[model samples]
Target: MKSLMQDVPLTLDVVLRRCLETGVGVEVVSATPAGTVRTTWGEIGRRATALTGVLDGLGVPAGGRVATFAWNTHRHVELFLGVPCAGRVVHGVNVRLTDDEILYQLRNAGDEVLFVDASLTDRLAELADRLPVRAVVVLDDGAPVNPVFADAPRYDALVEAVRETELVPRAKPDDAAWICYTSGTTGMPKGVVSSHLACVVHSLSSMTVDSHAVSREDVLLTVTPLFHVNAWGLAYTSALANAKLVLPGRDASGAHLAELIEAEHVTVGAAVPTVWVDLVGQPHRMDSMRRVLCGGAPATRSLLDAIARRGWAFHKGWGMTEMLPSGTMQVQPPDLDLDSPAGAITRVGKPSAGVRVRLVGPDGQVLPWDGRTTGELETSGPWVIRAYLDPDDDSNDTRFHDGWLRTGDLAVIHPDATVEIVDRVKDVIKSGGEWISSLALEQALAAHPGVAEVAVVAIPDDKWGERPAAAVVAADGLAPCAEELVKFLAERVPRWWLPERIVQVDALPLTTIGKPDKKALRARLSSPSRS
Candidate 1:
């Protein structure tokens, strides 16, 4: 009964070689500190081969960790190929982490070779002595003089001096390929290790019609940082599809991204909803864009309509670091009437193939997908992490049950498998023994013409256990009153969900990754000046 089929190993080298073979002429453009640089996939492949030789010369052991603290530039892309293809784990450290967090990740990962950006030399030099790194490779045109890393080598010297030859050894599919840490919003950051097979499957699964819909003809302008969740897995998908990549290094501002999208003729762009908010009202020509992939937070109805007016579709995705960053994507059925005002704010769509999703109640019972019973969302898939890196770390115990990851996201699943995220488990407002969704309230407020940004948090109330309060940031050229906003919400949502107080502020506090820092807002509301 055995059917014979040729067995092939799924590793990073498979895609790296495929890119060179099929996409040798595709352009990889990047805006670097020096200036705009352009290179072909063939040239990058050759350079990456040379870099692999350099890493070998540096005595990088097989399965050793090589860390990169850089932006999404062409050089970083090379590290994406060189390190993993050379059988070394690519540990991408988030550059925006706090000084102490940066130190902790570098030391905890036990990274051997530190490949840092030139701009971060001073920061790395401060903690280079404490890390287990044996060599420092500055990823720049020339090595800068620093007493702490004076002996470090420059990226250009090492690559150019080495011979152009493939040094990749045969690797197993289960070999560790990359490591990226969580945002550490609550506790110390935890590492998520992705194997070669996991990433290969994720990359292939992501480009399907229901997911990102990537192809060779698509030009992707990735606004997400490479250090965070594999830049939403754009790196691997682009290579797999032989698509053109445009990297906007360091400067992800509205104006800069607008210019790059136009200049590069970017057809598809991916970033969080906050970035889209910044670009929506700004003067930018986004006519070339066909679709925008938004994640990290849900997109408001206003934002979606604004993008639709420009003839571009807006998509919402829901995921975390543990799921290889892609769990669900927004896809409306043809029968659904999305043109209606009520249907404008779309839900996070069904899970992709090979992923199983369910909602569980507080009593450990599975909730039905009836679109009414709200519960904690849990997911399990080939790409999802079954456990954290540390064997004895029980701090995240409540985060997992059996083998599924407890997403800590409060959501309702429809009969069609589509999910509408109501709130985070910690951010949901509990008032009078009824649950109030802060995200739902925020979405309603954001639809107001004058309300530009809004974040709702639960504040202490004597009558109810807690009441919802809003931190409003007005839109440009318009100032809205609290009474008008309250009336606006009264028409849309239940009167009980309306905020008792609305505090106008210049801007909402944002996390390092540009998410609304609700934790800080809660602390501020507890203070006397705000209370």
Candidate 2:
């Protein structure tokens, strides 16, 4: 029988209240256009109270959704703490998404209120009637001004008179605290439903020195966009953990990101490998960043080695939106076969502290930990979401077996429990009955001196069902032919593993979340481009 004590208060507001008592007056620094700004947890708590009052004024109920289509800023961070803490769900929508897709998700999620940046007031206007928003609040650092809202209430004035209303949000541990939507390019982005218990459980599991390694003394710099899994779960963890948070404030460019890292003495930072790579490409070390958490795509060995040389530990963070994106951490293993060219650097260290990871074949057979056995990664833990908003879809039906969420990621688990992903399950190429690793190909090609960026996709081949083709960006003054690049990789990969064709370009298209747009690359192969 389950213990009654197990039903104890596990809601997010519980953590917020605890932090207010314990971590009050802790600095929350955010780099903004008006120079760096600083505030404390108490002020944030008060602001959250104000926000909750405003939410109430705007007709947001306990379960109603208050959407945020803004970048990472102090105001955005406030929503992270206050909205959910005040007992309302904040649907952090990805701003980079198309107008249509964004509106589709906004409607699908049935957002009742919106908190958007003044810059994106136009985005909200386009979806106004289509979306179910009852009010629209435009947030800014200065005196508030009304934006052109056709019907929704202007937010600045809504919360203007609010004096810290003690809005202690009510939420059961199992009640949904937040919701996140996937990039619907493949299909309509599935909204991931997570509970307060789930988010808190995942945070405890991820808080260890081995995982995200967050500490009160440390500062975290990120511009990964708050719309993505509550900024990949960093927003919630930082506030509840009392970690110094440095938001990149709308400018996630390489120069701006480097500046924040140096100015704030950012000890811990995270972004896609593309952003980090851009930082490394800069002439000098901006500041000594000790730890970097990278995901949104696999971190190639080449990129990892570059960070290592500069005394930075780039841990591979692998997770989907469903798990609150907290599943695996590839820290350097003790038995890392340093002799093996790949093990000299780190691996996704191990399944996050409390996460149980399993690789299984068809028919539900668990695979071995030999690292040679590759299978679909299935996981179930305190944080893993059980179902989607519309759980009837058959596409997502096969995503879970029993209670474990089939990650759709092809991975190998070493004896040490370190998870290394080779490629996405759907993207793995089969050519004439032979499996080709697109990840391995991309990693090898990224090592070449002249190659600035690369994306490999399987192209239709009549002889072989599909063959590998690469879309590559070359270094300045270097015009390497597809044949020449192929020869370069030939020396590294198996003859059959080499890409049959290559498309030279200046840049690779990327998903809104900063992943190399393999979907776009696959589109190009439909009509191969020539330099």
Best by TM-score: 1
Q: How many residue pairs clash in all the candidates, one count each?
A: 0, 8
lDDT to native, each model: 0.83, 0.76
Sliding window of 10 residues with minimal summed lDDT for model 1: 333-342
Across 1-531, the per-residue lDDT of candidate 2 in tens digits comes to 976665557777766774566667677777655667798766666676687788767778888887888878878877876787667787888988887877877887888877887656666665665766766677764423334553445555665678766656577788878889877657678989888888787776667877787777778887678888888777667776788788887777778788777777788887888888777666657665788888887665556666766677666788889888878776643333434734633245578867788989867899998878888889988888677887676755777888889888888888878777877787889999989988888878877767767888888888999999888888656778878888889898999988777888778899888888878778787564423
State residue 24's C-alpha deviation in candidate 1, in Å: 0.8
Model 1: per-residue lDDT, tens digit, 436-492? 989889988988988878899998888899999899888888879999999999999
TM-score of 2: 0.92
Q: For model 1, which pairs clash? A: none
